[model samples]
Target: QQQVRQSSQSLTVWEGETAILNCSYENSAFDYFPWYQQFPGEGPALLIAIRSVSDKKEDGRFTIFFNKREKNLSLHIKDSQPGDSATYFCAASPNYNVLYFGSGTKLTVEP
Candidate 1:
């Protein structure tokens, strides 16, 4: 099982700069942490989320830096323009049911 790891499949920004994508997970009872943002065909919705006592989570330009004891988590896309590109998923859940996805991260916000 790959537990969950979205090191990176794609990422490139320039319009304004700011496109980081790094996530890690290994169960540990996961704690409902979600972060999705798609724009190709449209599906992934939730933009920011953090549970496990919360470490950080924003919503405007997007931001989420959680590290529940090093479970690992990251997703920051500020200024980055160009419609913020697309493709970004780093999810996990062990409370609100099952939900584990980290096979995506193709953001190219170059203008």
Candidate 2:
């Protein structure tokens, strides 16, 4: 069964705008979240991440907003560029053990 869920199947954003990808989880045991970005023909790479202890995590133009009580999170891509277009997967783990991934959200950035 799927434990993680993404709200959007696809998203579009213009250059310099912020792209938001939302996610939620069913397992409260999950403590670690890693958002992965994948380009065509390439493996997903760690974009940004957050622990249940942190309500937010920011890395340059990328930021993760997490709400442990709500069991939800969102990834914000600030100043989005065309090169930022890709598929993003939200994954959760219980004590860094097995990971549960959400169906990816494909992001399209228009310049």
Candidate 3:
């Protein structure tokens, strides 16, 4: 009950377009949720996060929509660009520890 099923393949987004990545979980014990934004050869940065107690989270051009009842979540990027292109991962932890990360989404924002 500690698994986060994420997209195995990468995604491509054009400039000024919104990219949506998907994630889901089978475990109900998960409580802490976080979405990480990563660039080439760099560790993921904590973009935005939301708890199961909450519904949604947003930060700047990034937004996370979570559904506790459905046990699913998604990340929406506004104004997609070449610079905004990168790999994104959705992660969750039980008791705020032992994070389970998604495979990853490779987003190429073309110009």
User: Which candidate gets the maximum lDDT versus the true structure?
Assistant: 2
User: How well is each residue in 46-97 modelled by candidate 2, as lDDT tens digits?
Assistant: 8888999999999999999999999999999999999999999999999956
Order of candidates by lDDT, top first? 2, 3, 1
lDDT values, one for every candidate: 0.86, 0.95, 0.87
Clashes of 2: 0
Tens digit of per-residue lDDT, candidate 1, span 8-45: 89988799888889999998899988888889877889
Candidate 3: where are CA atoms >4 Å away?
A: none
Residue 81 error, candidate 1, Å: 10
Worst 10 residues of 2 by lDDT: 93-102
Better of 1 and 2 by lDDT: 2
Clashing pairs in 3: 10-106, 11-106
Q: Assess every candidate by TM-score.
A: 0.32, 0.97, 0.92
Candidate 1 stretches greater than 4 Å from native? 17-28, 31-51, 55-62, 65-74, 81-111
What is the alpha-carbon lDDT of model 1 when measured against the actual structure? 0.86
TM-score top scorer: 2
